[model samples]
Target: MAKSAPIDDVPTHGEGIRLGQFLQLAGLVDSGGEAKEVIREGDVLVNGEVDQRRGRQLQVGDIVEFGGRKARVSD
Candidate 1:
């Protein structure tokens, strides 16, 4: 089994940040366009479901995986 990376300083309560921004912050995808491409191709997963929206709001406790890297939002 592959282990996912840990997200530091997860937000407790907020409107949540943009999915693309989050991916960039985590150093997952190289650029916004790349993120969009990967998302549009249905290569990204959120909470075990395929999430193709680049602007999707992600909250704490949400799990995101892409490009063999995984991240879990923590509070």
Candidate 2:
């Protein structure tokens, strides 16, 4: 099997965070507007699937990938 990309753990400030917000919190994007743009351009993934919903709720253990990097949500 091929090795998966490394995943960095990202802690949320609350119980959960929206995909767009998570992007910013994870330092994947510089701002919320950038997150929205990236999501709209199909540059974001959730749990290995392409997701375009900026408001998609993300919780612990959820994985997000962009720019060849992955981030795993942690409580």
How many pairs of residues collide in each model? Answer: 0, 0
TM-score of each: 0.77, 0.90
User: Candidate 1: TM-score?
Assistant: 0.77
**Candidate 2 runs further than 4 Å off:** 1-3
**Model 2 weakest lDDT span, ten residues long:** 9-18
Tens digits of per-residue lDDT, candidate 1, 5-37, equal 654444434556878877776678889998899
Q: What is the lDDT of candidate 1?
A: 0.78
At residue 70, candidate 2 shows an lDDT of: 96
Clashing pairs in 1: none
Candidate 2 residue lDDT tens string, 8-70:
999885577899999998899999899999999999999999999999999899999999989
Q: At residue 52, what lDDT does model 2 achieve?
A: 97
